[model samples]
Target: MKNLIAATYAPMHTDGSLNTDKIKDYSQFLTKNNVSGVFMNGSTGDFTSLTIDERKAITLAWSENKSKDLYLIDHVGDPSLKVAKELAQYASDKVDAIAAIAPFYFRLNSIDKLIDYCKEIAICAPNLPFYYYHIPVLSGAQLNMASFLEQAKDNIPNLAGIKFTNNDLIDYGHCKSKANSKYNILFGYDELFINSLPLGATGWVGSTYNHLAPLYYKIKELFENGNMEAAADLQSKAIKFVELLNSKGGFNGVGKGFMRVLGVDCGPSRFPHTTLSDSDYIEIKEALDGIGLKSWFSK
Candidate 1:
């Protein structure tokens, strides 16, 4: 709720089990590092690969270890409305807000259906702030800003804002144009933080922020102080780091590899998600070392 600069979770285990201790450790690590918030059980967290119990365990662990200063955004996004509702209920008191993706896999061609789906989830967690996640590319739901705004105004009260992850800046700009000034628009793409901040985005939410929070904090401070050139330079470095990670297979492998390199020991990603090659690990180590972030690799 308080200007969220959040990190999405990296699934902590390869067996598709919730590593509660690791989650607690990671949550505390984020808290200590000054991250404003966290989005648990999200795309980077491999929510689809996890069982309901695993998701619940991760949420509960985070809740238990979470500092009052750290905001928790529980991503209760499952294809099943019932499971999502139940998870939301379970997380109601623990997290600051609850968010969900539009039901995916099945094509809901109409905006009406999408609105209805969101409304239903809203109904389930009336007390918690509900952020609608708009990642159309992965979810296969094209959310038109106009229609969503119109529907949300009429139907939902707890609908606080959106976590817009689309790569298209035009789509983000459109949403900003239509969205009320009070609504919090969180940019899910880490690389767009500097660009998005000027466009009325309240904060950022991304996997990279989990390990690179210090850099983001510095970048945000620079941007806020009107040092665009310095901010851009830092953002460029961050983007280059992310691009390097992506080249090794994006979040699944590289994200976990980053945690491992940082001595977090998060273990491997679930299968179907490839592990980092030995060469990939070496490349990552070299990148971290070049940045003088070698301390992260030391256990």
Candidate 2:
């Protein structure tokens, strides 16, 4: 299987309900822009705010509109094993692969515990290719390369690969070095695509791709075509934009702002993440205008 360059996040209405139409529109938007895949309802997608049914609806919407040329990776992470399994089953026929984070909100003290969690999910959907979503900062599960291999190498047969989100290049390199050729290691940071690819990261997953697919695909194209300098330059520009967004706030606010600017009708994030301030909007607009990306917002 080819390594997938993917984006993760959920699309919600102003009322905090899953916006099925917007989800379909976003999926079509990504496919049109040549994104290899899209992962729905992950951490970036605001999984914590969505009910299991809502998550399934978003997945189904994506599956319905995604072209034959594109792939879909559903993020089915839930604190409840039963809910996670139910979502996995619901997405089985809808996505190319299924991924889930280790049950978060509770500390998984040992690697074995994490492995067991994966195994249970794998059993739930035996035919699906299961990818491990590793974002320790949010999951409260600390998994190094050694512990991962030791625990999962034998038991989780359907373990296709990992979505490594931590900013540790050393750990990423270690995982790449240890991973068999069959396993895919996708980078989770949008800003580190340049460095991550050269270090054997085969794919990427990030929040920004929802608004900037063209730039991301261009960077990937440059790297795959052996033009490191050009790729680095593009990555630098992308990093600047990411820094601008982070400066405004974190992903929830900035990402919502981006969708609004793009006219995608994604609406605001749920409570705990309010609408962007006037200053924040100006900052985002100025940055986009400076980068000649104002067209993305133009109706």
For model 2, name the residue pairs that clash.
9-45, 10-45
The TM-score of predicted model 1 comes to: 0.89
For residues 1-299, could you state the per-residue lDDT of candidate 2 as single tens digits?
Answer: 34445555567666667678777666666666666778778876778887777787888888888778777788987888888888888888888888989878777878888888888887777888899899898888887854696579899998888888888899888888877676787888888877887787767887777777777667778899999888887777777777777776676667765776665767767656556865777777887688755543223
TM-score attained by model 2: 0.89
* Native-referenced Cα lDDT, model 2: 0.76
lDDT of 1 by residue, 164-225 (tens): 88777887887777776757778888878888877767678887777777777777788889
Worst 10 residues of 2 by lDDT: 290-299
lDDT of each: 0.76, 0.76
Cα-based TM-score, every candidate: 0.89, 0.89
